[model samples]
Target chain A: MRLINQRLSPGAGAVLKTLPFVALVLAYLLGSALRLAENPNDKLLPALTTLADAIDRMAFTADPRSGAYLFWTDTLASLGRLAAGLGLATLIALLVGMAVGMLPVLRALLAPFIGFVSMVPPLALLPVLFIVMGLGETSKITLIVIGVAPIMVRDLAQKVLDLPREQIVKAETLSASTWLIGLRVVLPQVLPRLLTALRLQLGPAFLFLIAAEAISADSGLGYRIFLVRRYLSMDVIFPYVAWITLLAALADYGLDRLRRKLFPWSELEGAR
Target chain B: MTALSIENVWKEYGDQIVLENLTLEIAPRSFVALVGPSGCGKTTLLRMLLGQEQPTRGRILLDGTPLPPEPGPDRGVVYQRYSVFPHLTVLGNVMLGPELQANRLTGRSFGAARRALADQAREMIAAVGLAGAEAKYPAQLSGGMQQRLALAQALMMKPRVLLLDEPFGALDPGIRTEIHHLMKRLWNELPMTVVMVTHDLREAFTLGTRIVALDRTRSRPEELLRYGATVTKDIAIWPPRVAGRATLYDTEHPQAQDDLTAFASPAGTTRQTPSLI
Candidate 1:
């Protein structure tokens, strides 16, 4: 606890952060070596060359029938669903959250319903959604929305309510209309929080999106990985899982940068 | 010269009454400092004047006209915090008033009009002694600077009345004095109605043309909150001094054991609200 509390120099901090990543990679290599020594034909833990060949075929070569690169196509398909789902969630959260936060009537009416919806496991509704929406793009997108929207709405509504009450009164004195105060004062303030919320939800979103795709979709990273799972193709699965991690990390980093740029004061506030 | 009036106003939160039949009249160009103990509803009264809170049964009038149900550009306010938007730069925060007002009146705030508004905002920023720091966000500003930026933002709206709730409560003594000077100059130049709520009686004595304090007169602990608070002391200070007035208010303050229940002003009305006394 004492060591964690003490601040480290920039260089030392960087090195400490990279230490665990390096250890993980080294451990995986050693495990692969030990397994391969036991059985060279082990498909469970294929050699590095086997994984590289799979990547080249999936990434570089176009499918003979469809004339499309599987890796890129799968990435585009998956990212599209994630973006659309997140976009829909954000819109719903802003509208519903701000209303519930600002208006007592809205809060009394919808806040409980949103809370109830959030408590229900989103994955449980996937079957219902697929059945009703017919396993199309809408079903996949709706699954992501349902999985994240309720949580976002609840989080954002609480944030709005937590806003210093004086600011609301101050904005009122400035002649700001109800819509203007929400759009101008409240909207800009909550955006960084929303981004932070989005970054946190990356895990659950990926889970729901992948589950939907695995169960129904013809094309997606999850679809491809689950399709080859019958042969126990761990090589392709490993890289695909790693790709998801990389993508989520990149997204988190991107949002952090954008938040810092657009809402510098939020950083100060968070520190306080 | 009656710019604002609160006639038999009362406010309550469920079982607790905060303000009880409060009646007051503010002149068109007067600096009124409201002083009270903690939980005396001075801040509540300020909010009511700004039209942020409706009086439970009474009406508020501005220039003999009933105040609109909601707060508008007719009134401006500064709080202890949330006085400035953290997301905007000093210039942006000050400019928000003009941009919002312009957009409301003319339905457009683009091109050269915005540039002109920026120029005005820059002038207000400079007036508050924050010229070089216009581009800095609120977090980048010192406590005093942020308050000054807040003042600039509120003043830019050109409000008929300005309400401040402990605007300098968080500032150091030195900066607070500087702000006091700035406020004196602004009030000297403009004839806008200003009401400030403060816990410091000395501050109220020095800054206000008239000072009013709120407290319960009766000493029953059980009925303290039920009875709530009403205006106890209202005094007019003569011969307004712009600068070097610190010596005037620094003479003395109520000692710790003075018992505000027995407190009353030397001059002006020591009168209670209605028949409370």
Candidate 2:
């Protein structure tokens, strides 16, 4: 039924799509080899066996001082904070953004202020947050919320505003009030975009979370990285940083799956 | 009795005048197709009738009473796009109005009423030839099916006056004919009053019982803004004919013209064939 030519097959296309990631790994390997050839004692590019050993020490063994597996404890702590911060930010964005987007009076009142707030560098608020909220869990979580919520609100509000005006007018003809329109017409359309906004905010959210943790934390991946910087222990730091990257990637993949499962229509519309 | 009345209506946006000194009263169960030049205010008038935009001066009335400040079940409209809710299945979209009304009256969805409403919606969807596709979403439908779904949804409310703004503008000729026949059937069967605005002269000719041509007839540019758009030509194209009844008279009969224009203004100008836009 089919003839095979020199052109790419489906399997080949899949491999082609992942070529860049493979190339990145190869480049890192080459750089590590060259650096180690020059200086066997260099901490800048630790050997792979040394990094594997460091992972075992951090992940398999418990820290004698704290009697806890450091890797798991750090992962759990950072994940909890990330989840809480993102959840709170999403709630704030949905409520405030929908209100502002739907009502003209509210849009006029808060839209400009939101724009100004988004423009302010989120890192600049870290010091103020630290002084006000104390260098506790509250401030670190607040730092992520402050860093990501405004931009998310702006994005989701624009999505609501961008909905076709005809739909609103049509809803009104059905005798739908403002509240019913929000519930029936706007919410379903906005929900998938919320997932998209969450995916986009992941990078910045992680940035703020780590920054907050690095500055002051007894236990976190960021804290360990900074604590080991004095000894230039590239083995532990590299593994920890790679772990964070893996976690972020997993979060993104999970969101994409959820969006596909929940709102399959989004994919169809996008194909257009 | 008059179904809708527009008295000395004027609409303007900042400095540009859209409609001026427009006066007309539509009697019960009349199909008036409005055609005009591209920017000569047909849409503006439709918006006013739909209660989406109000005239800067004068008033619009329905059943000899002023319309409510907000759009409701009393007035129904179908636009060119996004007419049907995308998230709803065909049956769900058709059932929205009755379900909403039922909710308002009872504070909950009654089992019997919902079943009765579903039956009614299914019958209407069958009338529009969308019976089997009742579970399909708007995106899954073709453009023609989507327009038919919109028609079914709007008709479910059974509004006093239905406003259509080129609801079939995107349809192909075959589907357009199907819709035309479907619309004529619905209009006659329900005896509903209709106001449709279209860019196609053929459509205005085929569907409109009374064709009213809207245009700025002013020759002078300065005074043009004064009488922005008026009923330059109002013609009786077809005598009102019931589906089962035989035709009584031709539109050219002076008595038929006189009868058609009774509620419309006494325009000294006779019906003239409109130059195509």
Candidate 3:
């Protein structure tokens, strides 16, 4: 009976947790059906049909066995771009965040600049970025930095500031230098929070990356979406959007799992 | 030689005065406890002595040199809250000071100093009864364990003096007593100039070789209250025996007994006077 009760408890919790997602899916389906029923010739049905056809075309190749490899290659190219952009941003963000967080006067002086720059949308800066950096990978990567750096810097700064006074005081009494205190005591405390922040910024980074690629690049999934959109080919556009969403969700889940693995003491899951 | 001296120290917070013309001297290898009511400037004085804050009117000196502008390993301080670094393992926190100073002092790489500092940290942790917990993080430990880790970290540097501000005030009475005994043991094992501030009078009397009482005036208005009593190194000088006699007489007085009987039934007559000894 005890084992049965334990088994039933988790099932109930899972259902409760999934209720919101179920509601969202139901709402989307109902809204689409209503729109199609009202206007039989509406663009919505054609867009969905085009999306279905695109998936079918991608699923079956001239040689069915090679279709999987083609899909894999395309996926890898998009994933590789994301990984590079994210890796560069993480390195830059961690370094800048530590520097700004450690030095009080520097943080104060640069806070306004970070705030002002973060307010400017990434897409709005595309033209200026293109003029300055050109329409290469540099421009897109630069866009990702401009879009993500400020958020990371702000989150990391706040996290550092939020550290308990006692921890710093403990270090001070031990005659620890500023660098020692930062490297040993402060960085370890801040890293887990920064990782969580990076995960939160992942969605925005992808959005900015896609926007940059769509406007200026000749390759990338974003570029393909734009090409299909020009001819009103919803088939290609819908599939790409779904692919990006799925990838974003997977990446976010993986990062959250990593965060838990690293800092088991944190109560972030309860926070969510 | 005087290990620490505070001459005519005055501390003010903008307009409000926290300490006024306070003076103290601590001899080497002595344990002194500073007892006071809340807001009597015990913490402020400790901070001033540790060089965390500067006195407004006077000076604090260590071994005839004026206190430095900021805290250093020469004076180790343990706060009421266990201030162990939550991120680093027990050994990491303990070795941090020596490793940092070694690099600056000798221009040696951190790798060169790591093994020696780690050995020292391990020894200190074992001394503090945390021998097996050296690899554990602060959060993984209990409150008592965390405080012990803080003690180990502070003592690992082998500071000339140790300053503690209500180090056991946040713990439950049982844990507080245990920590107090541990502190006394550590003090006996390695004699260094020590100054501690505590609200618990029993703690002060139990652990202190010399007790400096603050805010005694409010407790007794008619008699000239000794604001501070520095218990001499000789234990015979403690006032507990005399104080205990007076308390017993007061409790046994006819009027006192009558009042107690009025407050309670005849069953309370068996109550005895509380002992501070």
Which DockQ values do the candidates obtain, in the order shown?
A: 0.47, 0.36, 0.35
lDDT of 2 by residue, A140-231 (tens): 89988988999999998999999888888888888787887787778878888999999999999999999989899888888889889999
Ranking by TM-score: 2, 1, 3
* TM-score on B-chain, cand. 3: 0.75
> Which pairs clash in model 1?
none
The 10-residue segment with the lowest total lDDT in model 3 chain A: A263-272
CA deviation > 4 Å runs, candidate 1: A64-66, A269-272, B105-108, B240-277
Q: What is the lDDT of residue B244 in candidate 1?
A: 30
Q: How many pairs in model 1 have backbone atoms within 3 A of each other, for residues 3 or more apart or on separate chains, i.e. clashes?
A: 0
Q: Which residues of candidate 2, in runs, are more than 4 Å off?
A: A1-8, A270-272, B104-116, B219-227, B242-277
Docking class of 2: acceptable
Candidate 1 per-residue C-alpha lDDT over A86-115 given as tens digits, one digit per residue, 9 for 90 to 100: 989989988898899888999999999999
lDDT of 2 at A65: 91
Q: Considering DockQ, which of the candidate structures 2 and 3 is the better prediction for this target?
A: 2
lDDT of each residue in B14-102, candidate 1, tens digit only: 88888888889887788899998888899889888887778887889999999887788878888888788887788888888777666
Give the worst 10-residue stretch by lDDT in candidate 3 chain B: B249-258
The digit string of per-residue lDDT tens for model 3 on B1-277 reads 2378878777777755566667677777767788766767778788887788898888988989999988888888888764766656788777776766666543223564677668878888887778888877777777777788888888877878889888888777666656765776677666467888888878877777677765523334443232322221223224432211232212322211213234333444666667899
Using DockQ as the measure, what is the rank order of every candidate, best first? 1, 2, 3
List model 2 lDDT by residue over B1-277, tens digit each. Answer: 2389999999998877888889988878777889988888999999899888899998999987887766787778888898887777788899887777666543225678878888999999998888899887788888878888888998998887889998889987766766776777677677578999999888887777788899998848787666688889898776665333435431222221213334233345456657799
